[model samples]
Target: MISGVVVKHFLYCPAIVRITELGFEERVTDSMMEGEEVDKETVGNFLFGVLKAKELIRKPVYKYKDLVGSPDFVLGFSYYYSPLDVKYTNQVHMDHKAQVLFYAFIMEKLGFNVKQAILYYIPVKKLVKINYTNYEREYVERILRNIVKAKKGFLKVRQPVRKCANCGYFQFCKPKRVGNFYEREF
Candidate 1:
């Protein structure tokens, strides 16, 4: 099964998916540790009070066929459930949206009415709501197909130079340094 976290990482860099499939464990970075700390500190008091949700399930693992997702929180309301994810970053990115959309897709497949997804930015205390529509559904499906291809060793890395410096798998990737710039060597 493809995990939602892996889905998010695939969007960040397809090479990560292939590397993971090769059994190279990712080195946990300080930023990831900080994000976990932030989630632990802020999730309970801030999320519940702000969302005013009737029911809140923290880190509920949901599975549907070949996909599995454990979103930070699942909020239950009168008619539908919304997946909530907490990020330590101030800005929202496409990868983050993809992760939330993956969760929403899995929830829907399990017969839950999921109308929207929520992202909580810890640094800026920002909450962004994304409507789950056909566009998002198709987008997630396309990403899943790409992820499957990547797992089968058909991935081509096209990651940004800036991202490589901060990635945990940088050493394993072994990008060549050329005249003060790093170029990925396939």
Candidate 2:
């Protein structure tokens, strides 16, 4: 358990990102290689769009609360606030209710007004604006309270997730291996 003093407060951790992203990309490549048909969900294209937008604007980018403790993208604008987070999801807009609210909270805590939050859809080249309303603000604060409790093991895992062979951890978890994949780890 990490103490409050050592808790990583910033968003973008380069070391963690390198390790995790590489592992995920390796898995994706292995499954997608040799023209194997797999229903994979990815948000690379949406991230690209964010990058394109950033390139157009001359501002610093950072991932805060990272292991290194910095914003994901810190930009230098006339306004003091320079924190922005890019999230990609399959759903159009409202599905990302909890996460966007959390990001807004992080910004507020760091003394940023957080004027805008962008939710980009992968399948559709569409962007959605997340406004921090009073309702969402209160709701997210309640959720954050519950989340802190859960992190301390005061919460129980929700059950009844649909069983599927496609999830990567199925082999280790001993889920049904439809195509002999259950027997072989390779």
Candidate 3:
């Protein structure tokens, strides 16, 4: 099964493909972990509107064949559930949208109505609502299928691209120092 994080990497940067293939996932760093805690706290602080406790659903793992995700904050579950994902980046990336939408898709597969997915950007204090649509479901499925193919070695490793410079696996996958490059050749 593919996790939301894997989907994010596939969408944002394909250079990490080798890392994922090795089953060497990076540990969520301290700052990222703390951000999640803060996000939970922020949700707790709000007591009005859809952010209210009554609208929020907790402790549920949504799944579909080969797709699984446990959304941190789900508001209402039944005919429909609003999936809310809190992120630390002030800018909302496409992967973030895909992640939540994937969850919404799973919720729908499990026999619930999915209206939309919400992303709360902690730094900018912005809440972006991504309404679930047919286009998004199709898009996510395409990406998921490609990810599965990549995992099974059916797809060749994509050549490193510009995004590799900023990736954590940069050094391991394509180190610049001549000595490092020679060392990795063996």
Candidate 4:
């Protein structure tokens, strides 16, 4: 099964997905640990005090076919549900959007009405809403297809030095430092 996490990582850098598939363990950095801690501490404030969601589910695992996701929180409304994810960084990225959308996709498949997905940027106290549109759905599906291809050994592993510096699989990828940047040692 393709996990939502794998999808997020694949979107960031396909090499992360491929390295893990090859049985390499990721080295968790301090920032990653800090992110988890921040997620645990700030989720309550966001769910109850800010959004005022009717119901809040914490870390409920949802599975549909080959996709699985355990979002930080799932807010239940009168008519629909919203998957809320807490991000440590203030800036938003495509991978972050993909993670939230992946959760919404799984929720919809499991028969929950998901109208939107939410991202809580912890540092800046920002809440970004992503509407569950057909375009986003198709985008998630495309990401899933790419994940399948990556698992089947069809991935081009290239990433910028700045991103690789904090990646867990940095050691395994072993990008050679060239001048002022890093390049894969093909």
lDDT of each: 0.84, 0.38, 0.69, 0.83
Better of 2 and 4 by TM-score: 4
Best by lDDT: 1
**Model 1 / residue 100 / CA error / Å:** 0.8
Lowest summed-lDDT stretch of 10 residues in model 3?
177-186
lDDT by residue for model 4 (1-186), tens: 888789888888877777778888765799978768766666655565667678888888998887789988899888999998888887999999999999999999999999999988877878799999899999999999888777767555556678779887888878777665666532
Task: Give candidate 3's whole-model lDDT.
Answer: 0.69
Q: Which stretches of candidate 2 lie over 4 Å from their true place?
A: 1-89, 93-95, 163-186
Candidate 1: the clashing residue pairs are: none
| Top TM-score prediction, candidate number | 1
TM-score for all models, in order of appearance: 0.88, 0.45, 0.80, 0.86
lDDT by residue (107-170, candidate 2, tens digit) is 5665666555555444455555566667766875575454344334322221123422433443
Give the clash count for each candidate: 0, 24, 2, 0
Error of 3 at 95 (Å): 0.7
lDDT of 1 by residue, 19-130 (tens): 7888887767899787696565567557777778888888899988889999888988889999998888889999999999999999999999999999888878888999
| Best-to-worst ranking by TM-score | 1, 4, 3, 2
Tens digit per residue, CA lDDT, model 3, 78-165: 4567777777777989989888888888888888778888888877878888989998889888988777766655443433444444
Q: CA lDDT of 74 in candidate 4?
A: 91
Candidate 1 vs candidate 4, TM-score winner: 1
